[model samples]
Target: MNGIPKGRHSGASKAECRPFLSSTERDVIRLVHEPGFDRWLDQIKATGGCENPVYLAGYTTVQRAETGEILRHYSTENEPGGRMPVRCRNRRERRCAPCSYLHAGDTYQIVRAGLSGGKGVHDSVQHHPRVLVTLTAPGFGPVHRATDSAEVCRPRRNGGLCPHGLPVGCPHRHPADSSAPGRPLCPACYDYVGHVLWHALAGRLWARFCDGLKRCLASMAGIPRSRLGEQLRLSFAKVAEYQKRGAVHFHAVIRADGPDGPNAAPPPWIDTDFLENAVHSSAATGYVQAPFSSATGERKIVWGEQIDVHPIRGEHFTGEIVTPDAVAAYISKYITKSVSDAGGLDQRVHTYEEIAYAPVNPHIRALMATCWRLGALPEFESLRLRPWAHTLGYRGHALTKSRRYSTTYGELRDVRARYASESIGASDTLTDAAWRYVGSGHTPGEEEIARAVSHELRVARESYRERVTDE
Candidate 1:
């Protein structure tokens, strides 16, 4: 490794091998000889030396709300550097790994809380009718897909051709890792315009599915649709994940609770069988029509024919009921993978031509081109499809939950703030603070130290967890 270009290094320690260092690293090392070095290092270490931390110049003063007496005062003037740094807090892994890890942890806690009831939910809610369901997009056209066995994708008994004189069948078995699977058999025959528009409206499609389910439940119970909400409330925590075909689908955990929330027992009419049927019916029959455009008339969208609903049972961590744990783990894994696996650019495209030069797969590029093209139409202006071209016209959060599903992200962060600092408290408390953003990120040498510190902390944490588990 040392013989390779850029990988060469002296056998001595970095401290002994390096004859020169950047200004930032030198400044940080000098703080070791300064007074109160322990306190300064502790503050910086608290953030795990985040990959892209925000630097701020600020002063905060705490005062008694009633008497107006100062309780405490703090400023960045006394710190090692004349600025305080906070984590960049981006959830996308490509943007910031440390903050993305934090976001994933919070998401796991949120989902687990709803599943087994904790963190602001009643434990008894675990007994409620709960199940995980998947909603996939309908097929736009036949594409290359490898089956489990010797079957080929779109094998034609008699060979056929598309409108553009391209073959309609694929004979070769495409490897999963190969880009051939997602590419259309004939690109000219693919409904790229509808694909982009469907994703642009996938969220609304989910909403219509939910509404349709409610209507189905009311029909099943022999009650009016309007009166169903009074007896039972449906709550869900869903995340959108991209399929290999560069389309988005939803995996959601749905629960039927009482009128109040997870704390209350659902109406007597609610049961696992009934809920399952409702979900299936909704996905099958629910439909929404998009507006007509210049090149095409109105199009109706429906969930794909395939749907899966698995009933959740028993406790999360105990014997006889390991499904909940698997569900929670699956969600965490999906959220992390979605950060980079969507096959689209993590950043937005500023122009239509940018899609052509984007470092992405052809599937995503085609979808992006469709977005930019359709977005230019005056009738589609309200969809804002152009801005989300990076996402292939999808503009929805990776994670979404019902209002009463569980605690919120804001609440989770507030709890952490209260635990980490004494400054956080009731909402009514008065806080006088002013901060200006100085900059973000470290010099090359400074980043080297930060990465080392982060690695050490991770190793320490894993070791501690192993010991605790063994005990």
Candidate 2:
């Protein structure tokens, strides 16, 4: 008899009143007691079955096709511990540290491969003329910044106050990490349109910049635009990062490679000087126009005045240059970040209530409202701004690498699978497998137990590793 209320089971004997396991657990136990436990366990492990075991209601077998020889068979009963272990690819740091670490490591390796050349890329390609460039958004308004010179922070020329009674200028020297950094001195004057439009058109602006660079190179080489691709090519990997002021900026590794890609040498004429000129020309002229405002009839968008293009060089050049390693590390650091890193909203805005209650600054709030309003318009249906309101209407990839930059995501997965196979001395033969989302998540009690166990195991492992290293 299962456990029941005192009133309901008053007549049942104590022996019959024993509490039984849950139906789900009983189903799992039944499967574990089946004849094909070994094969079932193997399949479960391969498919990454679960953190908390799931019961299966299926069967499997292997037999000779022609002779019908019962070559092999397995059932759940043969499993050692009555359960299968599996890998969990949880991305949230709060959920699984191991998986998050794995993801970060893959990102680092991918970025590093593009920089120094590894995996499939040729190591010699690291010597190519390259640059680590950062493009910043224009000043929307006067924002507080740390300065060393006495004149830098002097808001008032001769000590005065604004109409609002705020100090005309700050005379004190501020530290770089001061809390007042990035706060607007006069929030009313901020050019919010210029800021939002810059973020929205960042990807398009990059495309135009690349085109300008190619044209600049072609003009210098005295080659036709159509023949430019045949002579040389520009390759790059870039990441978008948000500044403290909630504006998007870019960090890119720009490389000049042959048209044949990383495996081939560039044309003799395409040297560092040529690459530098192309970068400057592109940055100076790259611009994108915003959508025509119904109210204003016409409007224009453009890149900010602030642009940086640093030359990347190997030790042989002996000149000022950004290194490949530094570039890779810098880009990789922002791979896991979101708009939230820059004091912006993290979740989508679905209703007016959510937007009104959002804790972001007034400028960011205005952007969200704009995205929400535009999202409802039939003319802006394609932008899908509402679904991405939290991101301020930008729907481009956060980080993009060129084809020849490094090993691909698919290659990385394959390499990992091959390593696992090698460790088990398994033949590199494909196996057919199928799985479905039967269920997910842990029960409240089970979740608590699992968290505790995971924490204790991590602490023990860390202690052991530290002791070993100290020796």
Candidate 3:
């Protein structure tokens, strides 16, 4: 009944003349006619129209601890289908756009708190030395890349060929969004094994880099390594992003605090330039040796040559320095991105056949296959390349931070939850809650309706933002 063809074609037979409706349309009608439709709609709105909301069946009760009086009570017993909807809370945009949008906002706040302090962090952190750092993976082979300044992809005055007989240079100037940029010039010439192994050890390399930075800082201060922590503490928040060439790189906000933590001021010797120098030195010198395999031998993992360290500035600061807001927004943007952004899959692959059948370009497929092949080796079992084949062997989380860097995601969510719901009691409440997952996802028509609701909510937010900007 909901926009489905109510009448058949003019030239059709008796069966064709019957009113036709899809299962989704019938379900929509049934849903709207139910007594709990309004409550269901309200529940969806509460979840911000989550694409795949989980259904929960249970209740919560709060009572005054000393008075023995009930302060609040809530239950899903009367909800639609005897359950209430809650957001799936997936951070990947490809998985749930609504939840990811919310996650991105939280990420922005978390990163911003580190730079400019809020959400339980002391404001004194704003004065600390902060820098935006970019760490990249070493190149595995010659791959086409988008170039700025109108430069050719790989111009060569003397045309030459690789061992595989493919031209070693390209004269094309690819656009920033072109798919050809990430593809290797010659697939046969690419070091697929080396690329996969590097991805597997990227997390270890980052750890080594952090340790190297601490040593470098100690060396510059002319102090023993053991005593460095007594004078300065390095705090950072980082996000991993996949490059178009399928390599994972990191963007981080590094801050220098005193020995105590963010509330304490950094030492007089510490500054943006000081941190930048240490970052450059450590990135250059730091290395991690991959687990020795008889076939691959010992491979050393190190940061790429192009390390970008930009000093982070306050809002009023000018010139080329990146502002705190810019840094926060930059890191937040990457947290929602998955390996799929690099032409890879977000889901895990179980077998070689699954990797072969995955809907990905040849380069990504090759990387996955390489991960699977390498994962079988006893020496590389810890890397779990097979399980993470979908991500091209990169196993680290999308975002990570030092303990002193900023507020956490859990804290942010708790704040949001408290804001959404009224306080149960001042400090004298005893709360008990019981919940069980009932189901997830939506019927076809419900999916359509939820998407519409999500779009409308997004539009309302944008309109409100524009109005605020205008004022």
Candidate 4:
């Protein structure tokens, strides 16, 4: 009677007359009728409506260290399904928009603190000389380019053809969103090997460039390289961004702090011009050697010719001068992007068949194939190109900073976590915490509800911000 219609069918059997329900519909009905449905919804709200919330079973107890008095206690024994939900905290927007939003906000704070000064950094540091530096990769071959204006891509006086009989010049204009921007003029002419190899060596090249910069600064100050730290400290926050061509570029906020650190002022001699000159000198000369491989030969890695250095000003709007807020916003805009933004896969491709079936453009597919083929070589094993074929062999975190740059992501998260719950406020406290992963993800109906919750929360935040600005 529960599943079948109330009225009896004249000729049909009981099973044939039973009401039909999809798996997701049945799940939704069961979940709604559960005793802890409301409590479970509250847990979802706490996670900012995470699309892939991780389930955890755990308990925490806080007690006074001296008197052994219990201060606070939390357990998941009474939670829905004996578990709790937590944010996945993925930085890639394509995978988790809510987590990426939080990450981008944290990144903005980190960059802004190093420039305008906040959080743990002293506000006086705003007067320090800081610059936003952009380092690019050298060209491997000619590719179609997008333009903001009505300008032809790679215009040539004479219509020429490559060795493969493909047109060498692109007389057609491409808008910013056109799919043809990143494709090579001739696939055979493009240096796919060099592209992936450069991606593999990008992190090392950045390290070399930073070292060279410090040396250059020391040389300018007429001091020994080892003693340079005694007078001036270089602190930086950098983020990597993938271009339309799938190559990575680095954007860094480099600040010259006093030897004592951010709270102290830099030496009077260290000005914007001094920093700019050092950056140019280091980028022009710094180089790193790739691991020797008989298949690809030894390659020297260096920053490309297109280097941009902009002095960060304290003023918000000065027309020509870049501002701290502007730099922070610019860096935050790209912090959440992954290879998927450039028409590539977000997950690893373990097999050639996976690469073949991946939903990526032809240009990106070729780069992934190149990484896979090169990863088989004995000498290239250290680079681990195969595991990272999805990212075109790029190795390293998308965001990195010096020890003294600013407050860390971990510290920011800790502060948020504490504020979200009741604070113990005890100077001396003993805490015991144990947690374990139970499971992750949601059923189809749960996913639908989570997406709606996420959207509603996002809108509320934007509306609240608008009201505050108006006030």
TM-score of each model, paired residue for residue? 0.87, 0.72, 0.93, 0.91
Which portions of model 2 miss their true places by more than 4 Å? 1-100, 146-154, 158-180, 315-321, 374-382, 422-430, 438-471
For residues 1-471, what per-residue lDDT tens digits would candidate 3 score against the true structure?
A: 222222224235434544665666556555666898778887887888899999999999888999878888999887778999999999999988999999999999999999888987899898899989999998889999897757999999999999989999999888888788889999998989889888989989988889999999999989998999999999999999999989999999889999988988888988888999999999999998889999888888888999998888764444554889888999999988999989899888898999889999999999999999989999999999999999999999988999988889999898888998886656889888999998999988677667767887898899998999899
For model 2, state the Cα shift of residue 396 in Å. Answer: 1.8
* lDDT tens digits by residue: candidate 1, 29-50: 5444568656644654677757
Clashes of 4: 0
Worst 10 residues of 4 by lDDT: 1-10
Where model 4 places Cα greater than 4 Å from the true spot, the runs are 1-30, 316-321, 425-427
RMSD of each: 4.4, 8.5, 3.7, 5.2
**lDDT per prediction?**
0.79, 0.65, 0.87, 0.87
Give candidate 1's error at residue 371 in angstroms. Answer: 0.5
Better lDDT candidate (2, 4): 4
Using TM-score as the yardstick, the better of models 2 and 3 is 3
Q: What tens digits encode model 2's per-residue C-alpha lDDT throughout 355-465?
A: 878987775677777777766766556557788778876766767877777776578877987676434222432233333333444444333334444555456668998
Please report the TM-score between candidate 2 and the true structure.
Answer: 0.72
TM-score of 1: 0.87
